[model samples]
Target: MSVRRWWWVAALGLAVTGCRTTGSAARDGQGTPPKQELQFDPVTVTADLELDKLNDEELFAGGTSAFAANDFKQAARYFGRLADFHPDSRHRRAALYNAGLSHQRLKEWEEAEHRFSELADPEKGQGDALDAAFRVAESRYHLERYDEAVKLLGTIAAREDLPVNRRLEAQVQQGVCQLEAGRGEEAEKTLRKSLATYEALADKDEVDDYFPAQAHFFVGEIYRLHYEGVKLDPAKGSDKLAEDLNYKAELLLSAQGHYLRSIRVGNGYWATAAGAQIGALYENLYEHMVNSPAPAELNAEEAQVYRQELRKKIRVLITKSINIYERTLETAERIGSQSAFVDRTRASLEKMKALLLADAEGEPAPDPAAADGEPHS
Candidate 1:
């Protein structure tokens, strides 16, 4: 069935089922039973009245059920109806929030953006409004509207009214958007700010340790990407490019450190992700060492020293990659209990080991095929 049609059917079902009303059986009184009456607590009576009068609770419940059923459009409609019918109901704000989520699930980007935008306005809904604004930015980000996402996230990051953790998340997401937009320098700056923010929070013990680990991982990814960019560009071979190469190396090493830190403090999904990133970084570094050009201005002794340093770095990275893969394999085995991913990890580790052995046995040199008469310039 078409998703839209299925959604409508689900909505009709929920609407019918949720509003079914029940009543107590009538009492059969003989002659004068002393006029006994049932009494309800004030709070309970008020709650029941609110439930019956507003119907907001039922609406939200129906929306949640529809969402669980993967009927996102129905969920949106249910929540949207609550927001429309009970504009002043206490649950109006929550209804709007869930409506936005439903739109997100349905991939209705513009509708999600609109719902989030409405909730984000402080004058419109003061309590959870800031959180809604952040979600708005996040929605824009997933839509690949980088510039708009960056602007919205930057505003949220700058707001003193927002919680520190949310500010940090905003900053990290902003950095990610910047990186995606190919503004590496700006991305580096934003990521550094995020890391510093997390570090400060860590020092105070005010932030969850997970936030710091996430910041570290994100910063590491930024650095790793920067390193890969230089490695991929053939034009970056000038003497002036030496600084870029050194910077790349420094960043990769820094990223390796952070990834390792994340692995140490992380578990479950974060641990797996950090381990994979660490292994990938090491693999990339190893590839760079394998492909690096020989120094153009090195004497015999200097050349020997350079080659030795390069080999040492390569060795370290290979060992690191192996260890990361081992950790990933163990984690996957624990989680999935002999899944296909675990088997793939094992196979990859075996291949990496063979490659490491071959690299160790062979002498390092520029590929003969790359020795064509033409210069890179």
Candidate 2:
């Protein structure tokens, strides 16, 4: 699906409640146990009345109205008051959830965290409490407290009472937090676990492949970062240089594998991104191989052979990169995707072609058949 359509679906899904069932469930957790409801935007307040006279429900309605109108500050005020003043009211839990959501929309990270923390209380409602905790963890993530976010998500994911989907989400989110915290290795492990779980869920028809698609995309990102970190030395001796190049090749191929899996999962947006990244991976490889200096100790014949091999390698890399970009562009067009990623990929394809042509037009290497009686492949 196009991203715009996906976003629209998300917005509509958030505007309604009672579409899913949630009930009191106890688990071996310190606080409220997780529920199976798909609570996205919580319940919105829709009361449009004087604050002094408004009852709890009315106050909640007012908050909902404010939120729907994009007046997040007013929405937060109404929901916060309903949650605090009418603590025992039936609407209190929803009010608190909405308030936290409103505060998040306003970028009031601290207030959002506080509101979500309140609903996470086991003394209140355990049904949606896990959802609240999830929101709290997300708020911490927005605040750049990645360690705290990871910790909270981990706690949520550990609860047996939580639905499998929620647990998987928490696991993925925890990985994201770890990645943001510069814990790449930990993130990779976490994400890979989530990926496996997602595949299991997909196989059971418990969840869509979209979740695994997301996991694969993030895994690709982790490896892409690893590939980018591989440094090549132009001045190093041939042996060391070859070792580094081999290591770089391994990283690049690993990244390629992850990206290919992401694309194969068939999530339009992520697939598009992964396809584009595949192009970029090969482009980087080509540049690295091309710019790396040959060892100075080699005789003229050896140097010619080395240059010929390098050119052959560059041709393969650039051609593959261009092909991937073309595939990405076609996929985007096929999906009616309207993302900047598609535009960038198209531009990259043109640039890659130009680079390939430039390499092809460069000074010719000696024919191996003429020089050494060996046929060129």
Candidate 3:
């Protein structure tokens, strides 16, 4: 079944109470979580209204109106007031959630963190409260506080009482945070488990697949980074270089396995991401193999022949990369994918073709092959 992709890409908009609703039960976590992106011009506040003059109802009504209109700026104001001054109001909880969500939409991480923290109270840590915690963790993630995000998301994921989807969201995010924090071993375990759980779900179409796609991609990223880090040096002697090449190939294949799985997950964004990565694997392999220092014992004549022959061999790598890039570009276009990975894929395809052309035209370029390190997103 066709599924929604990212959280922001998830079409489930916030309700008047700021909770997401779905056809499934709330316990499924399908109806839990907030969203992002600003499609409408935000409503700006021209003047500060006296809080005493307007009742809690008025504040909530205005907030809901503004929120529905995607005027998150005003929504934050109204909801923030409803949460702060009218603490006794029944709308207080939703107010806090919406206020944080509004601030989050506006990219006010501190404000969003503050508001969500109020609703994330452990005493009331159920339903909306859990959602609030999730948002707080996301705010931390945006803030690059990966450790804090990981801790909070771990807590959220451990709650067996909440909806599985919400827990899944937390779990997936925790793995991503782990990845960002440079916890490769921990990130791999967390992300692999996330993929397993995602696959075990009975109703896969009912929730966003972004997390699973992320799991696959980040797991691939872990090994891809490893591949990039693993260096080969002919200066270390042919035997040691042979061992290094074998180890590097293992890392490369490991990375490739996960990238292929990411593509198989079939999310357009991640597929392009994986596709770009697959191309990168070959491109980088070319870079690794070609850039190694020539053995010191070689005569100038032998070194020239070595360079020419090695160039001939690694041209296949460039060809493989170009093919992968071309195919990825086709997929990106067909899926209407708009991601940095797609942009990178386009850029890489051009570079690979140019490098190949340079080889054909015998034009001077970087030694052997060039591989630009792919971004982590």
Candidate 4:
């Protein structure tokens, strides 16, 4: 469930950078010729070595070195020089891609997108344009251009020669873009296919096998949104209540099932999130029950019996909810998750505890939000 928001950070864990100190600029007779103000975006490259001695390959090496060191501005400058000045250089296409990557690392999405667009062009781009297409989609996704992201991802997914892993990643990203764009049914269809591909993989334990859990989590979110739209009215007779409750139960259970599947497939942050959400799901149902009015047709005795039954159900539901919250806490702790989510789960657990105690004491629980000084949802 570690959904990748962008490809910029993807290389951070895979490659460790070496230390490289920025060299002090040497003063010249004209004082560095009064820094040139260029018409295009600024791309300044500096080095301790003589500029004249550095060839395109050396410039590219400097860019990649700076990239490894996380100096995105410096990296972009070096790569940009190769892309802008060395048009005939064999490294031009790669330089463009690296420039895009450097800008991406700096969170300069527009600049990154521009560079990536050049690489995405079949006629002009060289070497692995398909991968460049994926990066272009990633840039668009981060910029909240969900429609563009989906279209680009579709192109990558449709390629016959693309690796299955890359294709699946593209499909998953396409589904994510759909979901973000509020196209739930389309998201579900695409994500379901991605999930099936993950499940069908011969090596389920592959390091890159992340889409299955993410797909499950997103599908559960779709169900959760739909469930929130359902309203149950207690003014309706018990028969009506029974029918409506059954329907609500189906929606909630569907969400719960997918959440559990996410947890089962991957015991990562997404699983913890799904676990926390399951607790919230049950608590929401309990709240609905507590807030509901008695049926108008019930006799006094029948109303009393119904009230008792309601209280029992509420307590049972909340208790189940509390247990799931506790499970989330335990899982987070077990995984040494120091994420803010772990703190939120802890706060939610405390709130659930108060809720359970409130029912036992026959008094309203202190506002769970007040107890934690943090909003639950």
Instruction: For candidate 4, give the lDDT.
Output: 0.74
User: How close is every model to the real structure, measured as TM-score?
Assistant: 0.62, 0.71, 0.75, 0.70
Write the number of the candidate with greater TM-score, choosing between 3 and 4: 3
lDDT of 1 by residue, 5-51 (tens): 12211122222112223344444575433434455433311112222
Q: In candidate 4, list every pair of residues with a backbone clash.
A: none
lDDT of 3 at 181: 92
Q: List the residue pairs that clash in candidate 3.
A: none
lDDT of 3 by residue, 228-290 (tens): 887787888757877988898788788878887888778888888988988899888888778
Candidate 2 lDDT, 1-377, residue by residue in tens: 21111000001112334346675775556877865566555576443344657787887777777767777767766776677678689877777777777677677788888878876732223556866788788899999999999987888767677667777878888998999999999999999998877766545456565667777888888988988888888577778878888888888778778878888778899889888888888888888888877787777898889988888877777777777788888999999987888988999999988987776678553343333221111
Whole-model lDDT values for every prediction: 0.65, 0.74, 0.75, 0.74
Top of the candidates by lDDT: 3
Model 3: ten consecutive residues of lowest lDDT? 2-11
| Candidate closest to the true structure, highest TM-score | 3
Model 4: weakest 10-residue lDDT segment is 2-11
Order the numbered candidates by TM-score, best leading: 3, 2, 4, 1
Q: Give the lDDT of residue 76 in candidate 1.
A: 67
- Provide the RMSD of all predictions against the true structure, rounded to 1 decimal: 15.6, 16.7, 16.9, 11.2
**Candidate 3 residue-wise lDDT at 349:** 85
Mark the regions of model 1 whose C-alpha exceeds 4 Å error after superposition.
1-58, 84-90, 122-126, 201-204, 232-248, 264-268, 288-319, 331-377
